[model samples]
Structures are given as C-alpha cells and as structure tokens.
Target: MKKSLFAPIFASALVLGLSACGATAETAEGDTATAVEAAQPAVYADLGGEPTGPVYRMAKADTLAVSGFDVVSYFTGDGVPVEGSEEFTVRYQGYDYRFASEDNAKAFIEDPAKYAPAYGGYCAWAIGANDALAPGDPNVYKIVDGTLYLNFSEDVATRWNKDIPGFIEKADVNYPTHTPDEHYQD
Candidate 1:
C-alpha cells in the first residue's frame, strides 16, 4: 500500500510547532485573498493506526521517535538499547518506531504505553524541571519502575538524577497541561 505523503508533513508541523487540532494556511492573488482550509486531522492510517493520544516528539534528524532507536530494546535482553531495523518498524502515537527484530515489534504492539517514553519522548529535565520542550536523546535514558524516561544529554541526565523522584512528580503534574498530541499548548 502507498503511504500518505501529507501525513508526515502535517506530523512534522505538529512536532516542530503547530496547533493540536489542525494547522492553517493562507493564499492571496490579485486583490482577492482567500484563507485556505486548515489542514484536516491527518488519519495516518498507513502508519498502522490513527493517533490516539498526545502527539509524540520525533527526533531532530529523520524525525523518528527515539531517533529510530528500538524502544523495546530498552527493556528486553541485556538492557542495552540497540539500533532499530527498518524491516521491523511500527507506528505508535503518531510516530514511526523501528525495532531491532520482529519480536521486538510484536512486543511493542502488545503494550506500547509500557515501552513508550515519558513526556512524549521530550527531555525529562526540561519537562519536569522547566515545563518546557527539549529534544530527548535516546542514548541517555533510564527505566524508572516500568516506565521509560529520556533525557536531553548526559549533563542533563546527571542533573535530572539529582532528584529523580521529585522530577518525575513534577513532570507528571506538568505534562497534562499540554494536550497529548501537542508539544506546547496555548
């Protein structure tokens, strides 16, 4: 099946900065001006399913969640995160997540919330401590209880460790301020 080329474009806008419901655009010609219809809520059916919750923050490059890292790898095996394989990729929460193997993909399909990162994969320090949006580095991560959390970097990760429990508490309270699919809310 063919993919929806427009989905990524709208999804990118949603990730970078755009309205949660839909984005608007304008066009003008001669003297008459027209406001084009706002982007429809993209279904992303080709991504395996429609987005269910808050929009996931994609990695800066290639726009893949966890920068294409296999989220399932964080919990299984040696506990070392591994690069995901294109052959076994799955889309969850509006982001395409790659896996190291088919089993990993199946595992993710079984329970996405269990493997998905906190704060929509935004930086733990930024969300909890600052209530801000910052890129999360898949390389710097931690599994607290059964939930996964990603930090901006080693330095930020170190800072976050200073008060993991406190930060988690603050993040939980702050996270809901913005809509699930939005990085920041009005």
Candidate 2:
C-alpha cells in the first residue's frame, strides 16, 4: 500500500480548522466579540521578597491577590495592571486589595466580586488545563467578558488565549474542587 502525503496534510488541516472553530472570544458580559483582540501582556513586579502575611487564596496562601495590583485598574486604566499602593486598601472576602488611588479602591469596595480575578487569583490556565492550583502571575493576564483572569506566565497567558471561552468554562467548573487545601492533601 502506498502512503499518501495529502492524507497527512488534510488531517492536519482538519485538526487546525476544528481547533479554531472551538475557540471563542467572549466579553466579560458574555457577548462574543467579532474578532478576538490582541492580548496585551500583563505588567507585573516581583513581590516575592515582600513580607508574607495573611493574603487571599482559593487555597490558603500568603500571597496577595493579583500580586497586590489594583484589580480595578485593569478595567479602568489602559488595561494594564497598575501597581497598587498601601494607602488605599479594601479587604473583601478574605482578600486584601490595594489600590493605585482612593477612587479605585472605593469602586472595588462597592462591588468586590466585579473587580476580583477569576479562580481566586490562581492561574487560570493551570486550573483549566490540569485542575491544579498554581500562583497566577500579576503580569500575565487576560480580561475576558469583563472578568480578569491571571495565568502563571506570559506563555501560559498566550496558551489560554487560544481558547478563552473554553478555558474559562473549564476553570469555572474545576475551581470549586481544586483548592489549595485539596491539592495539599494530594
């Protein structure tokens, strides 16, 4: 039997086409965008050297949410994570949110859920891809459907962009079960 090169090409094309079809870009409001916007790389700083204290987590951890960046800034500013200041802060749902301005802090306090990142600030890709808990890099993120989602790194954020809606759905489903405590036991 002779092997056909076109067979492999056709298979590859079909796979690519199908994968593209499966990807969806939905706005935070659940409305689909006609075209997915180019992902803006998240800006972050290394806060690892900072003192560890009571912080927010889907699983108990000593790291602040979104690396202490102003969550409200993602939506209000040029869609970049603005480093927050300690002067303006709000504690909501066991997490402390630092704000770049008093106004941003006030806005967040009004509706904390609206500003908080998905998956308790854990890496969205990690949760969706493996149901594992990984620290979400404040500098690597995406805002989908008006919601903020963080990834472990810029590479993971790019991968997560491939199937934003799909990953969001998967992460949503897995988040409740895959917590820090749950993973620690395993």
Candidate 3:
C-alpha cells in the first residue's frame, strides 16, 4: 500500500521526542511512513460502542474500565491502577481521541497494558506472523491476569480463534517485551 510521505517523520516525532523544545514535522518517505504506520496499534472502526464507564480515580483494586467497548474492566489483578484521571488527550494510532481524564491517560503512560487495546490491540494476522500491527476489532478482547488486551479486526480474531491456546502463547511472548508504542506516533 502506498504511504503518506509525511507519516514516518510524523510518527517518529510522536514516539521519539523530535527536539528538546518539542517542535515536530511531518515529511517522511512513503516507505518510511508505511513502516511507521505498520508498527502502530490497529485502528478502531468508528462504531461508538457503549461507554463502559468514565475514567475514575485509581483506587485499591479499581481498574480503569474499558471506556469505549465492553471488554474486561481491570488492567491487572495486582491492582496496579491503569488509565490517567486528568483530562488529557493524544492521538493513539491515527485516531484523534480523548481519555476521560489525565489519570486514566497517565495510567497508560505508567503501564500501557493497563490502557492499551486488547490482544495487544494489534492486527492478529500480523501478530500471528510476527510482522506488524493490524487494524483492530474493539469487540474482540481478552483479560489475562486482570489486564485487558485487544486484538486486530474480527477476521483476524477469527483466525486467532482457530488456535486459541497457541495464539495466546505467542501473544504472551510478544506482550511484555514487544510493546506496540515502541513503533508509532499519533
């Protein structure tokens, strides 16, 4: 697929602070842009799923409920709080969105798993092949050890379903060390 010329530089600026002053630009090669986009979490289809619940203050045993979709509620069993409470926003993947609060957003900053989409929230096919982040399906998710994870589109989820145990095995291997944010920008 042809990529936007400015996507890579833009993505790079997003993840790796472009300058000490924070000035950024978008002017990357098409291939570079494609590469950057390929490394990000899957894009969500705008379905406006039910609001699970608004972001709330982190409390003992309280996990940030999945805001947009009806997935698992907690981020971890240890009660490690996820999601920031302050009202701040960022462009995740390519979506212009806002978290309920900064605390909920900060939770993700501290530990992305607490807020990152499920199934690694990446493309299942790409994950299966260990290739790249595939666009995700918000509805397909899993809660492991209390942390929620999202997967790629349902089609990919269906493929993952074929070998549930195996897919999880690979995902487990990929999750901790292979964080998705290491790849993209806004």
Best by lDDT: 1
- Give candidate 3's whole-model lDDT: 0.43
Give each model's whole-structure lDDT.
Answer: 0.72, 0.67, 0.43
- How do these models rank on TM-score, best leading? 1, 2, 3
TM-scores, each model vs. reference:
0.68, 0.64, 0.39
Q: After superposition, how far is residue 85 of candidate 3 from its true place, in Å?
A: 11
Q: Model 3 reaches what TM-score against the true structure?
A: 0.39
Query: Which is superior by lDDT, 2 or 3?
Result: 2
Q: Give the Å shift of residue 74 in candidate 1.
A: 0.7
Better of 1 and 2 by TM-score: 1
Give the Cα error of residue 102 in candidate 2, in Å: 0.7
lDDT of 2: 0.67
Question: In model 3, which runs have C-alpha deviations exceeding 4 angstroms?
Answer: 1-3, 7-87, 90-98, 106-112, 118-120, 129-132, 174-186
Q: What is the lDDT of residue 55 in candidate 3?
A: 23
Taking all chains together, the TM-score of candidate 2 against the true structure is: 0.64
- Tens digit per residue, CA lDDT, model 2, 16-128: 56556764456768876433231211222222222222223433332346667999998985888898886675666445567898798878867877888888777888889
